[model samples]
Target: MPRFLREYFNRNGVGLGSVMLGLVLFWTIGLIILPQLSMLDFSFRPNLPPPEIGGPKDLYTLENYKYLIFGPEGGSQDYNAVDLKVFYRTLIAAVLVTLFNLMLCYPIAYYLAQTNGNHIRILALMLIIPYWINEILRAFALRIIFGESGVLNNLLVGAGVFDTPFDFIRNDIALYAGLGYAYILLMIFPIYNVIESLDRNQIEAARDMGASWTRIHRRVVIPYAKPGISSGCTMVFMLSAGALAAPQILGGPSSLWFTQLIYQQFNDNSDWPQGAAYAVVLLVTCILLVLALMRVFKVNMGDIGK
Candidate 1:
């Protein structure tokens, strides 16, 4: 067992620790790893009818993967421009959501973590109360808020800020906003948890050394919050990238999400291998991005566990 597990066992004793350990193993292996392995296997295999699943006709091939590039039958084109465009756009949108949440939440996290006040509880409640609702409900609520005649636009128009309601949904504003909002908590709490652990004396010492607020944060706060930052970024990015509901609910006519394509392969097209292939592509890309972010943050998996 790892040190954490050993420590956990010591604290909880054999019986309770064994139950927790079993649950963790079951969730990790039975739920996550097995499904992923199944999908990966399906991705490599050709789509076949139920009777032909294990028949001689059912041989593994790269056709499903190639289908993403060239369609069902290989065409003599460089690539499928539309699908690839959507794929790249989805990635960009996910990144934007991650960055948006980070920028918006970091200041709030700092305030909540560092400030001392009787109002902190109320402020924290105000921040958190909204997220008590389901993610889908929140997305729909955002749709209502950002629609042309919706709450925000209506408020602006009634206040004479605009002569007419803005086309936020049609303009793709709602999609981005909803994506960012959906994952905001993921960014905020991780940052808060890490920043809360930082010693106040270090910050005070830096201030006494005549460090400006910006310089103090740059040299002291952000560096200390690296592990939390990494965890938040990773969770936000992965969830944003894999999001289906937000995109489906708030997407504009031009806003085609990559997951929609994967959904279509499984449902509309009924091509399991093709769907698995698209899913595998997305999964691999997300893993690569996580690795890249970890590298950029100079954070190891062990640090993120902290």
Candidate 2:
């Protein structure tokens, strides 16, 4: 064999070596190179009908991006005001849902990690059982419970909590509830994995020193589990930001999400250029958030993954 091949096989056995090398090449070409080229190509394409003989003649125009990001004030066609509103609302909702999930999941994850016996088993089951059901089914089940004539409103009315059924569908509360339910497992798992790998001796020592539960949790546990928290928050935020089904079925007409707008642009309106632009914007936002979190928490991505 050649010197490089001999060294490569020495470092990595031939079978595993070829697979790893292929994967790296595949990722580099397909993910990094192709997508960047496609994004650059699509971003400058026109919103109008395609040319007959050539690819876009105006390949450097900013009209598609400008129209999508900011509404066209002087366009002949009807502008998408609803799209803009949905985009902002989705951004805000995702942030709120991520915060809510972090608050709710962290404590439970900590308990699951620290506790033992039946309690741990029960908590593990609680986290895992929901995954057995399809996500869309879960959303639909929530709809059945929260719908106008659903069990919740019926029971509320029966108990005289309210004279009539409250409008739960298409409301912000429903959106938040649906989002929280869908992402709760995702939030818990990362934190649980991180906390499980933590050294318990330090926490025991803190307690032995007569530290209060709150003080120990604040000073020791949180700092140690920061990687897990960062991973969980990043996963939940990204998923919630792109969520379409739960928000669509539960959020109703008024509660249109940004993903819905993107879907409409791509599928309903056949506006691929605008959809790509929206996707690019969402991608940029997610990248910025990941970078910001890495900076703020000083947690390496490798540690979180581990």
Candidate 3:
């Protein structure tokens, strides 16, 4: 670590390296560690009211965590079934959204990276323009579009695809689509950056050797883009899991995200400890998923940083 820092200083100059190092340390400690420590503390402690009448006393206990697995009263076989289902759905939906983005973005990223034209700027702007609006607004836009009487259904009906409007927003499809659209840039940019740096000669050579396009991508391009793919997948999964607004706005009655339960704990139930516990569980889940992906992809922290 010391040798790496010394090299960084020699390469980037002492003053700049010192500033960058300090910023990174500050960000890690201030933004990550301290807030998590605070949440951990909150998670362990019981939620207590003011010391007025007969209110619950403030004390550290594992009850909050237990309540998540067991029933609300604890030690029951029948768990918080709704909460458990929502949590499961949230994780599954996040993974699905990540896969969707990978499938949707990979071809586009490849095309964009390989192409050299003025239309690239226009296409990039089209992606960026939607995001220039607020995220909540974008989610609402999707809601409007997917609603029963909205533009999509109207188009389908008008084009004789259906006799009546289909309810897209009332299903999980809209939720996953919204989540994928929400993080499109994150998936595309990382993959594009890596693929753009790959030597075109390798692809040409493979083509010249009568290799199929799939073979070229699978053997040459994918291996080269593994780090970027891993990083993008990690980021998209984390963001999808942690996202609050899109799920709330775009989800139907059947789609209950775990984050919504956490929000209810904090706001509606006024149970800060339980909320903190839920948040901690989510954080741990995301971290574990990241580690698992790293192992599966043979990627390291250094590759993710790049």
Candidate 1 per-residue lDDT, tens place, 56-111, comes to 98888998888778754646677878888898888988888888889998898999
Q: Tell me the lDDT of candidate 2.
A: 0.83
Ranking by lDDT: 1, 3, 2
Top lDDT prediction, candidate number:
1
State TM-scores per candidate. Answer: 0.92, 0.88, 0.92
Question: In candidate 2, what are the lDDT values of residues 1-306, reduced to their tens digit?
Answer: 789978998799989989998999999999898987787677677666765315546556777678865577676656556667777778888989999999999899998988878978987887789879998898889999998999899999999999989888856677789899898888888888878877899899999999999999899988888888888888888999999888888887767788887788889988777777887788788779777878887988786685
Q: Give the TM-score of candidate 2.
A: 0.88
Steric clash pairs (candidate 1):
none
Clashes of 1: 0
Supply the global lDDT for candidate 3.
0.89
Candidate 3, superposed: residue stretches over 4 Å from native: 1-20, 52-57, 74-77
Candidate 1 regions with alpha-carbon error over 4 angstroms? 1-14, 74-76
Candidate ranking under TM-score, highest first, comes to 1, 3, 2
Q: Is candidate 2 or candidate 3 better by TM-score?
A: 3
Q: Which stretches of candidate 2 lie over 4 Å from their true place?
A: 1-11, 31-40, 48-58, 73-81
Better of 1 and 3 by lDDT: 1
On residues 24-107, what C-alpha lDDT tens digit does candidate 3 reach at each position? 999999999999999999898887765622345666789889888886773456787777888888998899899999999999
